[model samples]
Target: MKNSRFSEAQIMSILKQAEGGAPVSELCREHGMSSASFYKWRAKYGGMDASLISEMKDLAE
Candidate 1:
């Protein structure tokens, strides 16, 4: 799989911003990412936090 330019933590932060009422288009513009990428991250990591991400990575290893 191709690596993402944004880290998981950064992705989570972006998603949090969305949840906090930021417009999707504005976020995409500010972060230089596509809306598709934001939605994809939401699908994969929507409700997760940093610890969960780290745990998932440890399990993957």
Candidate 2:
């Protein structure tokens, strides 16, 4: 069986990016992820820092 679970580190990293409040569309485009995946992660790990969750992204130039 392929253990297809996300690691804590991976989840946290995504959570961090999500917490940083990059536009959902932007995140989906930049990370090659989907809005559904983002929402799924958000539902699974719904305790990220709200303040950070509302802040702008710190994406690399």
Candidate 3:
């Protein structure tokens, strides 16, 4: 199991998994993360990806 302080890249990878339709509970179990931690990271880093951010901005009009 991974440790608590996952790096940014790790976070991104998990986020990708979540986005790819891997169940959040599965991610938490496979990665040894708590539901709260996962949700917290999602909220903090949600839409932080450069390409996604640009697309969102373009749609905001």
State the lDDT at 57 in candidate 1: 90
Local accuracy by lDDT, each model = 0.94, 0.66, 0.82
Q: In candidate 1, what are the lDDT values of residues 1-61, reduced to their tens digit? A: 9988999889999999999999999999999999999999999998999999999999999
What digit string (tens of lDDT, one per residue) describes model 2 on residues 1-61? 5753555456667768767876778877876767887788778657855344434224311
Better of 2 and 3 by TM-score: 3
Ranking by TM-score: 1, 3, 2
Error of 2 at 7 (Å): 4.1
Which candidate should be chosen as best, given TM-score against the real structure?
1
lDDT (C-alpha) at residue 43 in model 3: 92
Candidate 1 C-alpha error for residue 22, in Å: 0.2
Task: Flag regions of model 2 displaced more than 4 Å.
Answer: 1-7, 48-61
For model 1, which pairs clash? none
Model 1 scores a TM of 0.93
For model 3, state the Cα shift of residue 54 in Å. Answer: 16
- Model 2 C-alpha RMSD vs. true structure (Å) is 10.8
Query: Which model is ahead, 2 or 3, in terms of lDDT?
Result: 3
Clashing pairs in 3: none
Model 3: how large is the Cα RMSD against the reference? 7.7
Clash count for each candidate, listed in order shown? 0, 1, 0
Best by lDDT: 1
